[model samples]
Target: MSDQPANLREQALEEAALWFASLQDEQVSEQERQAWQKWLAESVWHREAWAKVEQIDREFHQLPTQRSFQALQSAGRSRRQFLYGLAGAAVALPFAWHQRDILQAAWTPGTLHQTAVGERRQLALADGSQLWLNTNTLITVDERAARRQLFLLHGELYLQSAPETQALRINTDYGSVDMMNTELNIRLGNNSAHLAVTTGEARVQLAQDTTPVTVAKKESLAFNQTRSVLTEGISANDEAWRKGYLVAENMRLEDFLKALGRYHSQGWLKCSDAVANLRLIGHYPIADTRKVLDTLAQSLPVKVRHITPWFTLIEDNRNISHS
Candidate 1:
């Protein structure tokens, strides 16, 4: 009986190994893709075993290309070398590695993600990373094992990366940054790109044309993705969304409304162009943005009107209050 179980285990591992090899070829026939999909869905054990192999393969790929080659080339090195490293130690570590490889090979380069209006999604990567995306956010994941990569096309997100054998990176319209055990928030504003780190640390290598800056815990920074203005440790104001709130410390009314609008459905919040330059300060509940609008109406000269359950417009062509 034990011998039968042992044979099954060996069979499973062999199947997994083959899948890993198949993933390397850039071109796979549709028939082969369908066949693999069938095998993955046929039995839970088959899927689970293949999943393990994939995780291992991803970690293998993530290794700095040189380091990975060295480890693979070294007779002394074992699979364990790639199993124990990551931002989060997945006891199912091999599973994480294998999944990474699987997803990378399957992804077509330059795939873009977009949210139409009141859409938000939480993405979980094969390597165990979690992305809390805000409405109207656009992003793409580039799954290279040696370095985990994400490209933010627009809007905001909260990222918690899984442990890996190598560094993890996030790319923006401006430049790219590597993250480790950290929480990062990104917002693309007019003429400026903003970043805030709530926990841990990040190394931001500015665009080659601009100056580089590193952001640490509880710090905020901004730069012109198109220009060379680099500022650091400005304030920790961007962490509000993580708690379902928007804490604006002396922010322009237009900017505040834009940030607040992400929490609600599309067309729900809008500010008149006249108040675009008006600066306001306070903590607004993102979870209940309507209440915040009410507060704004009472405190400021503006009036908030609900166009629908899904939309609201704020207008104050003339100033009724001064700050």
Candidate 2:
């Protein structure tokens, strides 16, 4: 999960699964075997994926089928998709949800890191710390700068700072964070910023403020260009994208979709006014946005409709929806 392109890794994993399937087809041909060998020679990632499939197969065989099934029946994932090939015998393509997006900037020259929509990246810092850049994010890090500094140009990130190292300096368009040892998430949006502290403490200062506000563990702060508000009720799952899930706990359908929308760069995700306030609760996988949508339709009284490749509409399914 070090800065490799997630999409490429996913491609390798899916292809590995298909190759495994074809090889097990009983009618497997010599050409198929040759192609598999050729594919394995292509890259280390490909071989790693192939090895993962073999290891998972061994683990599955070692466990009781019912016991294994009981342990892994979360979120109703198809057997074909097992959180990056935990089910080796599955034939359908599975996503590499653990895959991390690539990084162009190692805080070297230029020092800019960006991830495409739906892509996520993890970076190890110079000070034995780490950070994760969320979807459609861009940031700048000055690795050579003493005490270390990072700028969130846009999008979101989670940082785990080393307690023994110098305090990290995290800058945003609207504010800045200074912390010695802390685990936190920072999100930047249009005229808005959000901070959630999971461990330790962070001292944040708005651009115009002379003094910094201290945010402690389990606390969060939300602000605009100027005004800011703090809260403690933010759930730990607020940052679940790192685990490749969009968790909803008795949340409004509208709000859930909006959060889910971040994982996609498509046109839009909309619900009719009639279902806007409906409640939904679940852990939705994000590797395939369409699967998440399909899951939503199964649990909620809603219909999923495709308007265009870029647009999706969620409508009431119980009756002809007018709203």
Best by lDDT: 2
Q: Write the per-residue lDDT of candidate 1 for residues 261-322, one digit (tens) a residue.
A: 55554232455556667788877766676678788878888867553232255667254121
lDDT of 2 by residue, 1-323 (tens): 54788667776775665566546545556777888899889899889888886776566457565434322321113212342543243322211121111232343333778776678899988778989998777788887866678888767899999768888888887888888789999987656799999889998888887767889999999876567898985664557978888888899998888777777554346666668899987788876888888988898898887643333667677753121
In model 1, the Cα lDDT at residue 32 comes to 67
Q: What TM-score would each prediction reach against the true structure? A: 0.52, 0.65
User: Which pairs clash in the backbone of model 2?
Assistant: 267-310
Q: What are the runs in model 2 whose C-alpha is more than 4 Å off?
A: 1-110
